[model samples]
Target: MGLLFSKFSSYLFPNIECRTLMLGLDGAGKTTILYKLKLNETVNTIPTIGFNVETVTFHKLTLTVWDVGGQERIRPLWKYYFPNTTTLVFVVDSSDIERFSDAKEELFSLLGEPELANAQLLVFANKQDMPNAKNPAELTEILDLGSIKNREWFICGTNAHTGQGLYEGLMWVKKQMKA
Candidate 1:
């Protein structure tokens, strides 16, 4: 009877919703990661001109991820969706050494905003499968993750093509949210 009651109770209550905002420069595998999590498979994607919202259920939580366009012109519009983001998932093309500064600039600018002050940061050092990709440790230094003081931040090495290290990143987000 106890087990039956517990199962019924779960159905009576709704899963907690977590709003995750995914951002990055073009070709950083943001869209690919989104689809991989949502469908459990890799999919070809073009540059996101606007944004895409998808609900992905992880364990008992429902994560609503917003994949926004990462082009220069669309970056200004990102602030508009900053109101209630629970976590900021920033994807970085770790192999693109030349764009590290550009990525850092955009990342810090968003973090400085008051609207995102309370949001937890999950930086995916994406494209880790590439030969010249920067590891998470190197990215932490290059992106200055150590200097962020307002909220908790983590950098994870991930290869979206094989779905490697993606779950670990989400697991971190879940743990933080639960805390």
Candidate 2:
């Protein structure tokens, strides 16, 4: 599909590409976000088999989001697309404390890559509707991203089921593409 799109777009636009990747722990609502972009509704997001792609066109720039699977077994595949990404959406399940470590490890490994040397990360601290959810400040600390240079982060609370913060998050991604 990527090859077909590449061929099609090259003949059409000739020169256009995306600037982002969305990845995080499983159940972080990344797929939900993808659905919001494509269908305006993510009814059932079966665990992404490997990765998924969605495009958002705004202000003359095409933002292609590579929604990578967050499962431990699938994360190694993320590096394959790192070279083209300029920004990242690191979604987290704020109510799931047991998984924060996994999220942090992935974030650290991603930041270490030269491909993502200057990526801007938007951490969606999701599940804010749940009583046990963690807030943005806690997410910043738990994700352990204090040392990453030249990266900006926004902590948003989202109930993926209700689509709260979904559009705002994409708009933020749109903003970064403009910058």
Candidate 3:
């Protein structure tokens, strides 16, 4: 009887709506991750010029994801998309150690924004399948995630090419939304 009630409740409330913003440096695989989450398969992607919005359903959640371009020139445009964001998914190129500083700078800048004060942050240490990819712990230290005390945050290693860890990241975001 309990199992039946749970199923019935889920059927009645099928989807929790979430607005997610995906941000990162140009080669951090934000577009790739977005397509992987939406299509469940890899797709050839060019650098996003402005942004791409997509709706993806994971279990009982319907996520409206806004993937913004992360080039240096486009960084100024990111704030415009931050107003109603429920979750911020920041992708990082785990294999690119030289650019870690740049990524860190942008991430910190975003965190300082007043508009994102209430947003949950999910940082993806992306490209984990690459031979030189950094792990999640290293990324946490490099990104200074440990010092963050204002809002909910999580970090996960992900390989967008094979979809490993993508769902786990989304699940974390779902849990944050519930909290």
Candidate 4:
């Protein structure tokens, strides 16, 4: 069964290369999620200053992920990396209710960019392990994801500390990319 599935996946998504951008507010755990995907283990990460790029192979897909700094001072530079991005993974601090509006603003701004008009969006409600963490449904409502149209988008409650929901999110992106 394993071999059969492997062959089927390879046949369907042969050497597919996807460029994914990880963007969100600072302290949203974007870097943590990137390291979890790349290393498959927890690792300490400081706030990203500019950006960090890494590639990881998931199933039959090769994803080149660019995790850019989410600080206010660095947002202007995000446009420079928008070109050719196949997926946009926007991480949100599920426990941080104070910055939901900030995240919504940034997300809408990014979606408005012509360069990313065709990109698929995967919103990660990170820090789900926290006691006060919001679920994906609530986050979606708060972010007004329902209003989005004419683009592919998904939201998953993720806990970067234990790597939960990370693979599922990636798999969703992979499937969308295939479509």
RMSD of 4: 2.8
lDDT of 1 by residue, 4-113 (tens): 99889888864667999999998899999999999999998999999999999887778999999999999999999899999999999999999999999999999999
Q: Please give the lDDT score at residue 129 for candidate 2.
A: 88
lDDT of model 4, residue 153:
97
Candidate with better lDDT, 1 vs 4? 4
Candidate 3: where are CA atoms >4 Å away?
A: 1-14
Per-residue lDDT tens digits of candidate 4, residues 1-179? 99999999778768879999999999999999998989988899999999999998888779999999999999999999999999999999999999999999999999999999999999999999898899999999999999999699999999997989998998898788778
Better of 2 and 4 by TM-score: 4
Cα lDDT, model 3, residue 146: 97
Q: lDDT (0-100) at residue 164 of candidate 4? A: 93
Q: What local distance difference test score does each model get? A: 0.93, 0.78, 0.92, 0.93
lDDT of 3 by residue, 137-173 (tens): 9989988899999989999999999999999998998
* Model 2 weakest 10-residue run by lDDT: 10-19
Scored by Cα lDDT, where does model 4 land?
A: 0.93
Backbone clashes in model 1, listed as residue pairs: none
Worst 10-residue stretch by lDDT in candidate 1? 9-18
- Cα displacement (angstroms), candidate 4, residue 73, comes to 0.2
Q: For model 2, how does the per-residue alpha-carbon lDDT over 91-148 read when each residue is reduced to its tens digit? A: 8889998888877888788777888877877778888888889887877777766666
**1 against 2, candidate with superior TM-score:** 1
Better lDDT candidate (1, 2)? 1
Which model scores highest in TM-score?
A: 1
